[model samples]
Target: MNGHSGNVFVLSAPSGTGKSTLAKRLVKDVPDLDFSISFTTRAPRAGETDGKDYFFVDDATFDRMIRTGGLVEWVEVYGHKYGTGKEWVSAHLAAGKDILLDIETQGARNVHGTLPDAVMIFLIPPSAEELSNRLRSRGRDPEAEIQVRLDYAKHELCEYPAYDYLVVNDTLDRAYRDLESIVLATRLRRERMGDTAQRILEGF
Candidate 1:
């Protein structure tokens, strides 16, 4: 709809659903797939870089961005702030590189509202029990937080109908194939490739 050369792909799922794992592999396997590293108020973990994994800003700076309308879409999760900077993503698209946004369901909705043409895909675990097990096995959060995530997962699943594509990650290999196919299909979309088509047709 925007006639821009690059596409915005929003991949969202509940915690512990293997979205990040698959996303890492997808970006490597697909050419020209750039990731929009989010800005976070939370402290960086071990070996995390400032501009790579996240912008790593403090709460005050994050609030200032929100107030100034610097972020394309920002959301607070588990008491921490996360956002995608408007200039960062817009510049990437202007340079003709697609960007993949790994965000939460609520953030995805906000992005969709702003960029109505953005493609959205929802990743789902094989089952709810499996999702719960994955979260518990991580042993990162306390029992109360884990339970809260599990409850949130159930609600997140309900938003599946909103996405353009539903990918059930039952196996890594199969899911990767599906993800690649989606990327390829989106890239080949006639609307996204009108210039290429005109060149080929006119033999210029």
Candidate 2:
């Protein structure tokens, strides 16, 4: 990791909140917005491609990554591990690229601690009932596992105060609009746009 700029945008949500879908669409539509594909200890779900959806690894490899400082932020959820790699993010940011992290609440906190300039957003479902319904629609987790996720969500929701923005994923398109607005707005801040403004001022 070299001189990192810490121009990171982090999105955190409980399971079934549509965070992953939004993050993907945001990256695709936004210029200079790179998706930070995370490392995970969980087995790949149906339709999840390795190195695309996630870098799935075993426990030993994950532990070694933790020990060697390879991860920027990592956390254990539902007995599985998830992490963002340090080198990838630092390299991108150092090269003047913006990165979007789709992560859990704990990992978001950790990233904020490291990159104080990073923007944090929390995405939530419209209601607990809807949250449960979305999980069911995925058909990835069994009934008991869904219940476990819901219970964890109850605890995770308490961390909303830590986020800079809150997006309720009631409608996919509308939520994306709000998310896009936040990112675009952040880019216009003086800290980010100062160089461009300075050059224009000098020309004048």
Candidate 3:
């Protein structure tokens, strides 16, 4: 690990945990933060651009990327294949941009397995009841599916300790600040700070 090495941050959470909302807020608060646009087989949501929210591709194209090793990590979720492209992340990292990846727990695990030095954060809801409420509030998914998701969220929360940091999303503003602090602190690490690392060592 070196100061100049690009950082890869893996953010994981269950559906309705407010990971997306918190991530958006974090980027708005952090000037230099870059959100890695993921590749997906799912259709774009309303107002989401092709390259901005996700790289929309067919299943065959996604499979090709998988075979050709174009993705850093990929996973199938909710019947769609989603992945982060390696080139895009490497380019941003090489340019010294702090990148944040909003992904599912399985995808986060895959990224961690490959990029062990990367920082991993898990966002948690206040409770299972709150998670269900949030999901229901969205007005999506059938009752059966919502129940399924609630069950899945419970299982996902059990992996909290595997992450470098646990951010409870009771309040978006507070969670954003906590996540920003984590990124700033990580950037100050000796391995990532280079000359600053030497200066700190000298002072010590």
Candidate 4:
């Protein structure tokens, strides 16, 4: 076993809160941090690569993975299944590489149960009105679907208190900075820095 394990950072937010964009940016800015690519039983959309965006699998394959314990957490959303691979996460953490999981609230909670050391951050819009506007701007969902998402967003907001940090994503640049800061701060925690501290003390 490795002497050290890296941190798992979970980012959760409502559908229209820009959490995905922020997560991508944070991974690009942070060194040695990788974004966890999820496996989904949904078809790839335009411009989305098979491995980059998600590992697209069929229902049978997804079910087989679940039965064999290959997935860490699996959830069905809008009739499609999405899950994180257990082996991939374990290997990275064992190698002392931090990982970023941009999943929904339920997935975050599930990961926390297994990896209790994970740092969960909740992102929210500046105002409910802004959230609604952002959702509408996507132009992909129908009116009814949009309403469903907005209602779900309200419920998601109530879970913010359970997160380690809450970031308001009113401005992209500011939100990215805040997210980056949280990752850096977690890395500098005493528990994570124990080996480095020991090495420094030995030199003195």
Top model by lDDT, which number? Answer: 2
Per-residue CA lDDT of model 1 for 105-195, tens digit only, reads 9898899777788899999999988888889898888999998998999999999988999999888899889888998899889887887
lDDT of 2 by residue, 1-204 (tens): 122353689999998899888999999999888999999999998889999999999999999999999998999987899999999998889887889998899898898777788899999999999999999998888999999999999888999999999999999999999999998898777777777777799998
User: Where does candidate 3 stray beyond 4 Å?
Assistant: 1-3, 197-204
Identify the runs in model 4 with alpha carbons over 4 angstroms from their true place. 1-3
lDDT of 2: 0.90
lDDT of each: 0.89, 0.90, 0.86, 0.89
What candidate 1 gets wrong by more than 4 Å, as runs, is 1-4
Tell me the lDDT of model 4 at 156: 84
Candidate whose TM-score is highest: 4
Minimum summed lDDT over a 10-residue window in model 3 is located at 1-10
TM-scores for all predictions: 0.93, 0.94, 0.91, 0.95
Worst 10 residues of 2 by lDDT: 1-10
Give a tens-digit lDDT track for model 4, residues 1-204: 125788899899999899888888888888999999999999999889999989999999999999999987888877899999999999999899999988878777787777788899999999999999999999978989999999999988898877999999989999999999999999888877888888899999
Better model by lDDT: candidate 2 vs candidate 3: 2
Question: Candidate 3 versus the native: TM-score?
Answer: 0.91
